[model samples]
Target: MTDDGFMGPPWQMDWTPKAQAVRDTLPEHVRKTVDAVRAELVTAKDPYFRGVDTDADLPDGMKVRPIQSSVPKGPRIFFFGHGHGWLRHTFVRRVEDPQIVVEEVFWQ
Candidate 1:
C-alpha cells in the first residue's frame, strides 16, 4: 500500500504496436511529454487519472470516451494536451497483470 493508503500495487504500462508506431513519429520534445505522462500513469491507482469523465468535460479538440468495440468491457480513449496538439490514446486495465495496456495513439 502507498502512503495515501491505496491498496493495490502500481500498474505497469505497455504500449501496443500501433501506439508505438504513432509514438515513433512524434518529435523528441513531444515524446518527452508522452514519457512524462507515462510516468504518472504507471503509478496511478486509476488508469484514467487526470482524465475527464464525459465528453461534455472535454476541452475543445480533445476527445475522451469508452471504446465499445474493445472486448472485456472495452478500453477508454482519452486525450491530453502535448504542446499545441492533443495526444490521444486508448488504455485498458488488466486486473490479472496489474497493468495498463495502451492500445492506440494519435496526435491531433
Candidate 2:
C-alpha cells in the first residue's frame, strides 16, 4: 500500500465522461491548474490530498474541495466552485477496498 493507505504504487486518478466535459469547459489556465492537482493526486503520497476538505453532503469518507491557485489573484480569477469564479473542485471517494476513486471534477 502507499503512504496514504491506498493500494498499489500510489493514488490512481481518472475522470468520467461527465467530468471530462466539465473540465473541457474551463479556460486553459484553469484547466492546467486542475490537471496539476490531478497529477498531484497520482504522485503525492498523501491519500486525502491533505489540504482539501471533506464533502459535507456525501458520506462514506468522500472529500471535495477547491484546487489551489497558481496565480496571485487566486483561483477566483479563472474557475468556479459552488458558483464562484474560475474555481476547480476535486472529488475523492474511498471505497471498501484499498483504492481511492476520484469521482468528479467540477469546473463551472
What TM-score against the true fold does each predicted structure earn? 0.58, 0.45
Alpha carbon lDDT of each predicted model: 0.58, 0.45
Clashing residue pairs for model 2: 78-86, 79-85, 79-86, 79-87, 80-86, 80-87
Give the range of the ten consecutive residues with the poorest summed lDDT in model 1. 82-91
Candidate 2 overall Cα lDDT vs. reference?
Answer: 0.45
Query: For each candidate, C-alpha RMSD in Å?
Result: 5.5, 11.0
Cα lDDT of model 1 by residue, 1-108, tens digit:
546554454676778888888888998877876676566556545555334543443344344445554442456665556234444444444445656777666665
What lDDT, from 0 to 1, does candidate 1 have?
0.58
Q: Which digits, one per residue and each the tens of the lDDT, describe model 2 over residues 1-108? A: 556654543555556677678778888976766665555445544443344342332223223343454432222111223333332333353543433344455553
Provide backbone clash counts, one per model. 0, 6
Winning candidate number (lDDT): 1
